[model samples]
Target: MSADPGSPSAAQVELDGVERVFHLGDSDVHALRDLHLRIGAGEYVAVMGPSGSGKSTLLNILGLLDRPNGGRYRLEGRDVTTLSLEEQAQVRSRRIGFVFQSFHLVPRLTAAENIGLPMMLAGIAPRERAERVARALKDYGLEDRARHKPDELSGGQRQRVAIARATIMAPALILADEPTGNLDRSTGVEVVRLLEALNARGVTLIVVTHDPQLGARARRRLLMEDGAIKHDTMAAETV
Candidate 1:
């Protein structure tokens, strides 16, 4: 990575000739069509579109949660389209982090436990997990709430916990889908700021959102409609 964030080098994620079709009873629903995208490290990009514009479908493919019916996808220079499901899962765990509209915190787990869940799943040592979890709690201002379960936290706090968990593994790419959708405007702004700060540190940030104001804040914007990219632009100031 270079000091210039926008300069293209080895892409974090790439899609070429990507097409996604879904079977709806008998008819085929085209969700994404011939989409080509390259996201470089440290870039802050936003994907925007109305409902049924294939935004979520595109995101699913980027996160390796779904496969395109046709085309190729490369993640960190590896041709991921050829990997098995288990292999894809490993790659996703190692390189990608996701935050959804809903906080998606485990209702049964405390904030600290939820933040440490990824490390736990990867079989990290108890001592190291405790150390990392402690840092995450303080970094995200959740130290005081570490013992609070999801039901005990506010909406903003829950989202913060989710963000903390998502970044715990230090993934190369963070894919956020309406990360602030469920929060109030002020809280949403705060969450967005946190995500931007992460991007400033060279973590690739790709956000999908229906809010135009939120989308425009990104350095680069991609608009999708009818299962294809309708417009792609980089802010003049970003260049």
Candidate 2:
């Protein structure tokens, strides 16, 4: 889809003085220190960093999997840091999508069942759930593999299933952690193209990757060190 001319370029994610600290014995390890960031809707952002630089920590906080010891996180103009555990879960389920390095599909479930997990947890009716799952299977090129388990699908197919599951709820923000890390170069490229297609459709895409090649594809790149954003720059039309 083409960009919407009238769509407002507004802040979708806002972070201010965000701090995360892990206490180990008597020592406190600062994972994120006074981090401040703002991301606009429909923006494709990539985060690159070395190991132990708190890349995972940032992603965890953004996904609401971990809480900051200090500061505020405002999503779509509402503060989420203060929300209770259940309240935060509700927001995370509806407003955010997560794609991990591992294809976290249930081994016991079929491809179609895995893709429809979110709606099932959300308590959607059986008929509508079946219809949406059918469309998702076709949309993600898993129609023939609908009844197959994760072990039965190829690596790319597994990642595709994971992607389908992530976006099934139509979340506004997608947090991808090393999405292509598990695939070969060729298959990784295919997986990335699928992600880019979703970004083009106006979802906010943030990818955390160690591969410079993958990071360069994003319009904006963020370099992290010591849990802080060291560099933020715009790349050329490398996509």
Candidate 3:
């Protein structure tokens, strides 16, 4: 998946001839078929599809949580498909961030601890990690909730902590899987705005959602069906 020759910015993500297959018992299920996609920096993309349409599979591959059985994935001009598990983990930690519907915060960790987990895992110095976590807590309006555990926070607060944790490394890309699925309408709207704000600040944001309303908020939309991109708003706009 190459960037358009005339495009201004470089592609942040590229997938070419990507294929993902899963074997269950005696059958093989094709999760993604010849999937090709290119997303530029600072773009806001929404991936929407029915169940079993490979939306989750696509997100997994993008986040390096899973690999495609066939094809190439290039991130920031580097072909990551060939990278080993350790190498992929390194890239994932430094370049990609993930926000999940469930928040996925460690139950025992406080909000500040959760936001600092990535830096801690990457072996960042304690002083630096503490400073970054403090900044994140303030940036996300979680300063007062710093010592509260996940179970002690509200839905919106929990999601804010997850987002702060995800972006603490200043990743080039943010992969959000149903980020607002767990919140009520108003809270979900707030979470979506926070994510959009990140995109506004030049972070590539890709969100997977079942809500049409939520999907519509993205600048570009990819509609997938049967393991293939059925519609691309960007392509449509160009025509």
Off by over 4 Å in 1: 1-11
For residue 20, what is the lDDT in candidate 3?
99
Cα RMSD (angstroms) for every candidate in the order listed:
4.0, 3.1, 5.4
Per residue, candidate 2 scores C-alpha lDDT tens digits across 35-64 of 999989888999999998889999999999
lDDT of 1 by residue, 88-133 (tens): 9987876788899998899999999998898898888999889888
The clash tally of candidate 1 reads: 0
* Backbone clash tally (model 3): 0
- Candidate 3: where are CA atoms >4 Å away? 1-11, 235-239
- Runs off by more than 4 Å, candidate 2: 1-11
* TM-score sort, best first: 2, 1, 3
Tens digit per residue, CA lDDT, model 3, 7-98: 12223899999999999999999999999999988889999999999999999999999999999999998999999999999999988989
lDDT of all predictions: 0.86, 0.88, 0.89
**TM-score, prediction 1:** 0.94
Question: What is the TM-score of each predicted model, taking all chains together?
Answer: 0.94, 0.95, 0.93
